[model samples]
Target: MKIKNLIPGLLVLFSPLALAHPGHGGDHGFESGILHPLTGVDHLSVMISVGILAALFGGRSRWQMPLSFIALMIVGGILGVSGLVIPGVELYIALSVVVMGLLLWRSVQISHQWVTVLVMAFAVFHGMAHGAEMPFNSHALAYFSGFVLSTFLLHLSGIAIGSAVLRFSASGRLVKALGAVVAMLGGSFLLS
Candidate 1:
């Protein structure tokens, strides 16, 4: 099959498949970690948008930004596991989604280094949440690995979506419209 023909199927696969959060159990481990991002709309939205943001930036950022997010998220996770609290972590996470959505909406092509910094900042909060929410006595390594892997996949999905959209259309209006929708969804998540 031609690569072009596969794009639509891949997009369908990338689309959010779940709408509901899963129930948590004691000793949340690898399974929990994998589900964490999927269950949290805030995290899922921001992670995917970060990927699109990279596409918007269109360069080394396509990889650098996501890697930066993953690396810093580990740092934040460590902090959370250590019980060092950052005030307003949740607020920052939700706000990251809103901010990312706006960046996409604007189709802002920021310097990769700056965008990496911003993504790192946002990732800390996300990682912190993962650490903070981990069930007591869970396999920390397994959980972290699960979430990290899932996060990487989510980023890839976003990248693919962004690339596909960019290729077929000369106009960026569609991307901008997607950004607007993302922004609105983030905003609603923030309000509640």
Candidate 2:
């Protein structure tokens, strides 16, 4: 759409990356897990982009998409913790952001079932990444719970923002613009 519409989304997507914290180490707990997604731009962008995608899709997708993501993410996490290697986890994760953003930018209409599956697929990478990073001696259950909770909150935040943009702004250009920004970020990740 219009360049102005993309500006807001770009800002939201990029601002957090600039402020992302370097990965932390040492004692792990619920708190550490919660902070993990917030610390990395990749995690943060993907999580939020999922929420936005859900919101844009509307209907059952609003809840189903996010739920599917969390469920499959847990499974992915299990795979990671079990030492199952999935090649190109980083590449897939980055692709998720790009695809989600493109979908949002284009406002592509896909069925809820397909959307759920799409989200679930991307979530595996996210969950796996988190699982692989678990501290060797940390409480696995607690850490998993922490990241899940944090991820849910981020999705909710994205939904709220997306909903507001769609409802308040005329033409909903803002959301589309944000999607472009998210996609750009993904492209940057792929290149780096």
Candidate 3:
């Protein structure tokens, strides 16, 4: 069958992701934490887009941006675990995907300072989501560490993909298209 024929099936696979976070009754640990981000399309998109943006910016932003995000994310997680509520965390998390996708699509360049600020802004929400949903019986440190590691890996993957894509002569269009699809996903979720 052609690729077009498989689109509907693939879209169905992603339907449950609209909820973003669902509770778990049993104990969860490092493994569960690691899988949390991967299982949710919202988390995956922003994490990867951050990496792509880092790659696009190059130089100091390559490390500085990701570090800033991770640091702020940890703080967000702490806030979440402490029951300090940030109103509209879920809406903002979904919005992150749309914002990031637009940046990627347009290939916009902002100052390193602005990049750090924007990235950290969204990072908090992601961390909060992970924090708020943490299993009741899980080891806090291990679970947090698992998510941290997972976020790092996802960023790394985005960097690699972005770098590789940039090397190609037709990369701009491909990247732009990717951004559109990502934005659409976030948009659909918001509208739904």
Candidate 4:
């Protein structure tokens, strides 16, 4: 089968597993945490969108935005593990995907600082989600390490895709199309 055809099937197979509760009579460890981000389409989409946006911006933003996101996400994660609540975290997480996809679609240009701030703001929700869902039985440090690594890898993948798109003269429209799809998926999450 073609890779494109196979891709959807793989995602379908893994998605349910990803969304399953990690600590509810299930094994919990570094592996479980690593899989957490992959299970949620919303998380995956938003993280990838961050990468794409960063790559599209280039320069300082390419590094700063992702770094800011990572740092802030860690803070948010700490808040979550500490039982601190941030209202509307789920809503904001979905919104982040929508906003990031729109930004990518428009190829929006803004200052690096502003972009970093935007990324950081959205990251808090994602981090909090990760923290809140962490299994109590899991090794906390290992779980955190696993998720952090997974998130970083996803961002890198998005950056790679974005870089390739930028390199091709005819790929701008393709990138925009992807952004539209991501936005639509994010909207679906809001509805569900």
Winner by TM-score = 3
Give each model a TM-score: 0.84, 0.85, 0.89, 0.84
Q: lDDT score, residue 64, model 3?
A: 81
Question: Compared to the true structure, candidate 2 yields what TM-score?
Answer: 0.85
| lDDT assessment of candidate 2 | 0.81
Model 2: per-residue lDDT, tens digit, 3-100?
A: 99999986765564543444544358677778877777888887887888788788888898888899999999999899884999988988988987
- What are the per-model C-alpha RMSD values against the true structure? 7.3, 5.0, 2.4, 4.0
Give the Å shift of residue 13 in candidate 3: 4.0
Model 1, 1-192: lDDT tens digits are 899999897555334443223454325688888888888778888899888887767788889889999999988888888888598887788688788877787786556677678889999999998888776767999889988998999999889888887897669898888888778766765666
lDDT of 3 at 51: 89
Q: What is the lDDT for 162 in model 1?
A: 86
The TM-score between candidate 4 and the true structure equals 0.84
Pairs of residues clashing in candidate 1 = none
CA RMSD (A), model 4? 4.0
lDDT of 3 by residue, 25-83 (tens): 23687877888788778888889988888887788888887888888888888877777
Error of 3 at 181 (Å): 1.4
- Tens digits of per-residue lDDT for model 4 on 1-192? 689999887566445454344553335868867888887788888888888888888987787777788888888888888888588888898888888777778775556567678789998888988888888788878878888898899889888888888888354897789889888767766665
User: Candidate 3: which stretches are off by over 4 Å?
Assistant: 1-7, 14-19, 23-26
- What is candidate 3's CA lDDT for residue 150? 90
Question: Which lDDT values do the candidates have, in the order given?
Answer: 0.80, 0.81, 0.81, 0.79
